[model samples]
Target: MSLPELLLAGFLLLSVLGALLLSLPIAAEQPLNWHQALFTATSAVTVTGLGVVDTSSLSLFGQLVVLGLIQVGGLGFMTCAAMMMVLLGMRLPLYQKRLISESLEHTSFAELAQMVRLVVGFALATELAGTLLLSLVWMPEHGVAAGLWISAFHAISAFNNAGFSLWPDSLAREVADPLVNGVISLLFIVGGLGFVVIAELANWRPGRGLSLHARITLHASGGLILAAMACVLLFEWDNPATLGGLEGLGAKLQAAWFQAVTPRTAGFNTLDIGAMTTPSALLTMLWMFIGAGSGSTASGIKVTTFMVLLLVARAFLKGQARPVAFGRSLSARTVMEAVAVALAGMLLVFGCLLALTITEPGQDFLGLAFESVSAFATVGLSRGVTAELSASGQLVLIATMLLGRVGPISLGYLLATRKTESLRFAEGRVHVG
Candidate 1:
């Protein structure tokens, strides 16, 4: 099987195994039926965080199972397998390295081994730091043992961008708290920025550092976050169920920042998603569609893809022959691929939304569409319609989440499995728009 298909198969297999483990009576407070088990497993594997069942209701064993799935899925199946090989003192096979390359979208094999080791070490160290910092609040609030566990679980979840919260409201109670907001927001941001970016930034020097990918990611991500935060604050400032409910401006701003960060596929919510104004919700969908940077745990069309589209638009509008960004001309192939990925993602979201609308005839149109986008983006910020979706609708979401996590880039490649002739065709003339 091709690497993409194998990767896809790996996710399916892991989801089933996780579901089976979580279905056992000892795993959850109430035994999960196959549907609940599968959905939760798929969500965890995709790191989507859309839970039909409240995670708080899950027994510790079930939660742990989910954590395992998130780690496997977020770090990627092949990466973990490769790391295991390293731990066992075995050399990575060439085939395995190819698999890792496909998964990480890396073209260089020379530094592959060193890069993988660095990624794993970096991930563990980040999660540990997050756990230590988060414990300051939770450990005192809940007792030593439960709080420590909670802290660790959240640290992993946030760093992995998994968004699996043990709390019923998913940290809504801590919306105004600076420590909680800052730590969680930073975790998802770093997690979504891509590992390659992180590794480079760690050893960066003054004035001359950062690769083009890292530079693009940092600037685009920062701009999007700031824009999203402004949109949320401006649109929902007076909405009682969201930022308006807070006592002070500082709390509202913190909550706004948290909301802004979550939409880019983190799935953690400090404010009531459904209660936000329509403008804020629409703004969120835009951000979710244009999710975090490439190679990050978070998914969507990706920030780079969105940036490419914007550059393409700019070129067309200015009647330029080529698209350029930051003094570098973008390749035509890169531009076309970005267009394909974005278009495919939008169409998938649309089709899923249409299906859900048919299945859920009485539901609100905007909410269902929002849920579909959230699932397709793997963003996990629901509008309170998740638990209420029918079995078919939930299945649709499961598929979308898988697509989101697996991504359109790989899926697009999967279609062209056969070798093509080196024949060039003339551009066909078509009617102008």
Candidate 2:
């Protein structure tokens, strides 16, 4: 099978396996029907945190299963499979190399296995740090055992960008708590930077700088995060239901910061997302659609894609021959691939929204659009429409989640296609609007 097909099949199989396990009576505190199990499993496998059922209601075993699913999902099944292969002293085939190359957004596979090893170790170390830091806050409040569990779970979820919270309101109690807010926002930020960028940055010296791709990803991601934060703070500065509900400037700013970054595909909400102002919600939708870096746990068109489009637009205005960034000219193929990825993402969200319009005619366009973008981006930040949706709507989201996880990779494959020319064709010109 092609890379796209393989990815689709593998993710589907994992989702089904997860669903079957979650459906077991031992998995949940209450009986879990097939639909609920399937939806939860799909969400977990996709690393999208949208949940129809509250995660706190699940038994320990079920939560563990979800955590395991998030780890594998965040790391990509093919990466895990490659790790096992490396452990067994097996060499990767051409196909495996290609998959890893594309999935990790690496230009080549010279150090592929080494990079994968670093990825695993980095994830383990980061999650451990987050767990310990979070334990400091929750252990005092929830008691040692429960606090430890919550810390570990949140660390994993936050690092994976899974956004699954055992608490019903999702860290709402800790909006003003600096420890919880800081650690989580940082975790997701690193998680969403893409493993390749992390690995490269880890080995860097101050004067040595970094590669073009790494630089672009970092600069663009940082800019977007700051921009999103500013927008949210401005739009929600006086919304009584959101930022305004807090006590003081310190708490409000902290809440604003957390809420701002969450929509960068983190999904955890410090504020009541449903009660957010229309402008704030719309700004969040835009940030969620922009999403995190490629090969990261968080998903959307990706930071690189967003940057490429901006560069392309700038080049167009300047009448340049090609899109250039960081003093390097990007090939036409790369720009086209970026365009395809963004276009595919938009189409997927729009198609899901259209279907949802039929399945849920009661909700307004903004709510459904937010939900659709959230699902399609795998951001998992919903606006209270998820729980109220019908079974059909849930299925629509399931498909959308799968598409979110698989769609960009598939589009990547599509963009890689090279059509050989047997003869030259006449030049055709079209009018611009």
Candidate 3:
């Protein structure tokens, strides 16, 4: 099988295995039906976080099972396999190297071993640090044992950008708490930045600067985060259900910042997302669709793709031959790939929305649209529509999550498999306004 096909199969197998495990009576307080089990399992394996069941209600073993799925899904099955090989001191074969390189989008095949180490090592170290810091905040409240467990679960979820919270209200209780907000936000932000960027930053020196991809990821991410923050503050400041009820500007800003960045495919929100104004909700959906960097835990069309599209527009308006960024000209192939990814993502989201409309006729269009984007992007933010959806509606989301997880990788496969024209064809042209 092809690499993308293998990846899809691997992920599906993991999801199925997870579902089977979760279906066991010991996994939950009450036995979950097949659909509920599959949905939760698929959500975990895809790192999408949309749920038909409350995770907090799950037994300790079930939560651990979900965490295991989250870790594997976020790093990917191939990554986990590679980590094992590295640990065993096995020399990675050429085909294995190709798979890892393509999967991670790592450029240097020669240094693939080191890259795998960095990926696994950095993830473990960061999760550990986050857990310890979060323990300080939760231990005072939930006490020693439960607090540590909560801290550990959230640390893994946050660093994986899975957005799974044991609490029914998520982190809303700590909306004004700096330590909770800071550690959680920081973990996801760094995680969503992608492993390549992380590896580069770790080895970066003053004389040797960052790569273009790193630069673009950092700049676009920072700009988007700030822009979303401003938009949230502007649109929701006066809304009673969201930021408006906050006592002061400081707390409001903190909430705005958290809400703003969460939509960059992190999915943890402090505010009542369903209660936000239409504009704020729309903005949130847009960011969820944009997502974070490629090769990251979060998924969407990706920030890099979004920026490349912007560059394409700028080049067209400036009458330039090619899109340029950071003192480099993007290849025509890159532009086409970006267009393909964006178009495919839009089509998937639209199809999911259309399907949901048919499956959930009583639902509002806006809420359905939000759910569609959230599911496809794996952002997991809901406008209180998830649990209320019918079985068919939930099934539509389950399919969306699965396809959304593999769509980009499959697109990459299609793009990579393209063949150049063997013979030149006659020039064909069409007119447009």
Best by TM-score: 3
Error of 3 at 129 (Å): 0.4
- Looking at model 2, which ten-residue stretch has the lowest summed lDDT? 412-421
Candidate 3 ranges with C-alpha deviation above 4 Å: none
RMSD of 2: 1.3
**Candidate 2 residue-wise lDDT, 327-375, digit = tens:** 8999988898888888899899999999999999998889899999999
Q: What C-alpha lDDT does candidate 1 achieve relative to the native structure?
A: 0.87
What value of lDDT does candidate 3 attain over all alpha carbons? Answer: 0.91
TM-score of 2: 0.97
lDDT of 1 by residue, 1-433 (tens): 8777777888899989998998999988889998899999999999999989999999999999999998888888888888889888888899888778766666367767777887788889888998989999999999899988998899889988888999889999898789989999898899999877877887788987677778888999999999998899899898988887899889988998899889988999989898988998888999999989777788899898899888989999999988987788888878878888888898999989989988899899989989999998888888989889888888989988887777664754554344575998988999876
In candidate 3 the C-alpha lDDT for residue 340 amounts to: 95
CA-lDDT, candidates in order: 0.87, 0.90, 0.91
Which of 1 and 2 is the better model by lDDT?
2
User: Best candidate per lDDT, number?
Assistant: 3
Off by over 4 Å in 1: 412-421
- TM-scores for all candidates: the values are 0.97, 0.97, 0.98
Q: What is the C-alpha RMSD of each candidate to the true structure, in Å?
A: 1.6, 1.3, 1.1
- Name the Cα RMSD for model 3: 1.1
- What is the descending lDDT order? 3, 2, 1
